[model samples]
Target: MTFFAEIFEGLRISWAAIRANRMRSVLTTLGVIIGVLTVTMMATAINGLNSTFQTSISIMGADVVYVQRFGWFMDRNEWLRSRNRREITMEQVRGVERQLTTAQAISPVAMTRKDLVYQRRNGGAVQIIGTTEKQVETGGLNMSQGRFFAAAEVEGARPVCVIGDDVATRMFPNESPLGRRLQVGDRTLEVVGVVEKRGRFLGMFSLDEVVFLPVTFFFNAYEQRPDLRIDVKVGSLAGIEETREELIGIMRKLRKTPPGAPDDFAINQQEAFVQNFNKVGGTIAALGLFVTGLSLFVGGIGIMNIMFVSVSERTKEIGIRRAIGAKRRTILLQFLIESVLLCVMGGIIALLLSAPITLVVALFLPAALSPSIILIALGVSITTGVISGFVPAYRASQMSPVDALRTE
Candidate 1:
């Protein structure tokens, strides 16, 4: 009960001191405010990256594996070897469909960039994807308008197209896009469906700036012998490794290479993207935390320096308190409380500033001032106060009452 009373009195005295030296306290708190901002922002960015990556990967279909001629990332020698291999053909895709047991859906995909025109408005360098109705499933598309182009449409080599939401809004802002004709280079096609809006990938590249059309239409219009990638969607995530192994054997046999030589085709899975993202994102987060931690360190040092000055100026007060029978621990608690108050004040101000800053940051990057960040920032501020004020508080407590009184 005595200890609790002492702590209450300590808070009272400390708060009074801070209020009395309002200007000094405010200036001292600036460092802590800056430190809190950096830490909060860094944590927010790291969190945003994780969520954004998951969202983006889902749009690309996490369950689907890509079988392509070239790997997504490879060494120079690997690239050359892959370049020398025959392109994965529509025929091979059919073979994979026929033989593969693990795959639930298979989509033969090819892409090219073309400028799209709706009346006078031209969309610059829009990506065009050529795939079948299976693309609706394998690509994780949700139809916001109309429906996926039917299998009969693909079979009949219809020049119908499915537009992304962004394109739909941009091209036909005033009216429905369904049944409207859009020009894809020299070719004219009718929009049969509009895919739901998927924002950007990593808040950078737009995912909704693409058009999907039949594979035959793509081949006849773009490349005669198009380089194709087969998207193989699996049933179970737990069996992904087995799926990859099954794909490798099927590809090796399909390619008809001997058992000793390396397989010509690259079978890419979501795990590759996941593993690489984790490695890179972890390094970036570590570096970000380290850099932000320095600001806190500097703020702590500034608080320590100011606390020493505060203790020097209050030596006579300490002397009087000791003469009145104040314990050393009481003196220690008082200054420590004052330091913590200053830091907590800074943390509150920092949080206030973070609201607008977070809004602005969200415009360019996906960021949020989550509840966890708020708690962490305040906890850091309190901890910094304790660590910074300890040495100065100990010095003040160890002062001789007689010696302190003699200075005045």
Candidate 2:
């Protein structure tokens, strides 16, 4: 017979055998279902998290650079121990503005969490961001109701505020927030604008809970000197790297660092954040794969055990086939095909069940259930079926027709 003809015969026999033992077949397939579901669902959640991060950071513009006392993902304990580190000051921000010709816009930021009160209405702890008007525009924030504070308001330390969605919902649930007065740390500020609802960055971090005011206002009210972080927006994508290098050199000069002295400030780009996230995320993905592989390994073992039993129960039938000019390879292929079909069927069932769950998640965030992941899952299941069925297939194929038929 032709190679295709033998394959057809093997598939025919495999399907009939599986059908004859429907309950066993279903039980075997259940193992693969668990394995595939665990892996695919984990992948979906990871993909969603990555999507959220990219979207949130891209909103700040690719060319924008943030200069601060410390990098975002630097170990907190280590940063704190660096006591000799110079705090970035307002003077440094001004120096950057004057010295960095490549920079398009620069603004300082200071932030704290404080209780907000609008007359009798009260908002719980909210992020009080001390920033300039340019900070708003450079950060890509939009005003939903009013406008951001002016440069004059910032320099004068005026009590003008731009409230976020969370504050508006809590402090002025039923009224327009604009023109209202809100109190922050014993200082009453006129709510000049309500910012559009910028959704949460990660699943755990909320941006809409912020209130923006001048950094000078923050300095005046808190009476505590805080490290200032400068936010810079480059004019174009091509100028981003040049802008960063220029700003770093300017900061070094302003800080009066000698030729050999290390720069005291940190310059951060969005790609740095993406790289940090991916590093941590890659570790998590590795752990998830290890765990999912364990489950798949267990399923493969179960398939091997059941296939052994199946071969034992069908010994007489096998011997009769072998006596009727069936080759040993034919017997091996038949059993292997049966095992693979069982796993592939389970994979189909798993895909059907996971599709809906993936859709629901994608509704809230971008999640790719790509063809690659599907193909990987199928390949794993098929490999499991083949590897685990190997010994049983070999034993059955090696059986002598007279010895197999004499049993019982």
Best by TM-score: 1
lDDT of 2 by residue, 39-61 (tens): 77777778778877877877667
Tens digit of per-residue lDDT, candidate 1, span 91-121: 8888998998987888899999999998898
Clashes of each: 0, 0
What's the TM-score of every candidate structure? 0.94, 0.83
- Which prediction has the highest lDDT against the true structure? 1
Residue pairs in candidate 1 whose N, alpha carbon or C atoms collide under 3 angstroms: none
- Residue 94 of model 2 has an lDDT of 82
